[model samples]
Target: MNNVKSLNKWANAHTYLPVDLLRMALGVFLFMKGVYFFSNIQYLVDLLTPIDKIDRIGAGMFLIHYIAPAHLIGGILIFFGLLTRWAIISQLPILICAIIINFMGQMHHQNLLLAILTLAVCIFFLIYGSGKNSADYFFKMQK
Candidate 1:
């Protein structure tokens, strides 16, 4: 059908290299940050404790235990442009929470700025998707 062809065309559209580079950089940063948390998990737990009390959903332990691994896997997915949109969506909550916590808590201004920049990058990827250099592009070419 014509609709299917149109969809395929859109999927296979070329993207800017800079966008892909940005995606990879953000992914690497998130992956590294997640890895860092494992070495200093108590810090994450401390950050989430007040949020847990406010949300009352018992998310303190959950966020500490699960968010880092999710960030690691999601970052890899974004880096490779494998299921890129889903990966970005999955990570958005954690990033948003970080932004909120940074603002609400007494963290340094630099941390808040970094969270904002990271969130902006996530928004960009969400809107534009993985660029030409991605695995998605390679796979699309094969189709």
Candidate 2:
């Protein structure tokens, strides 16, 4: 589409080293979180309990299965800046649920702050797209 091409053009023009570093850091953080969740699924269960309560269709189980893989794979894709927008879009729902669970279940300042920060960064990347330092750009240039 015209809008996507324009956005991509803008992102390519505005690439910065610090932003790439931040994006990589976010990728590592999410990957670690995914690993943590995979090892300690009970935490996810506890977090998603409120969702289960709100809906009786065993949605929590589905979410429990969905989150770890999404984070792991999405994190890697984000780190490489390959399909960055799609990766970010996949992460958006998980981050939203993370923010929502804080209030619905137990309120923890650390978690609340982290969720907000991650969500904000995800939104930024969603709008900004991947930059020149990314695999996406490298491959695009190859074309």
RMSD after Cα superposition, model 2: 1.3
Locate the minimum summed-lDDT window of 10 residues in model 2: 50-59
Predicted structure with the largest lDDT when compared to the true one: 2
Scanning candidate 1 in windows of ten residues, the lowest lDDT window is 3-12
Which residue pairs does candidate 1 place in steric collision?
none
What are the lDDT scores of the predictions, listed in order? 0.79, 0.88
- Candidate 1, 1-143: lDDT as tens digits: 67645543564575667767889998898899889888889877777755646447665667777788988998899889888888988888988888888767677688789888988999877767787788877897799
lDDT of predicted model 2:
0.88
lDDT at position 26, candidate 2: 85
lDDT of 2 by residue, 71-109 (tens): 998899999999999999999999998898889876888
TM-score of each: 0.84, 0.94
What's model 1's TM-score?
0.84
- The reply for model 2, stretches above 4 Å from the true place, is 52-55
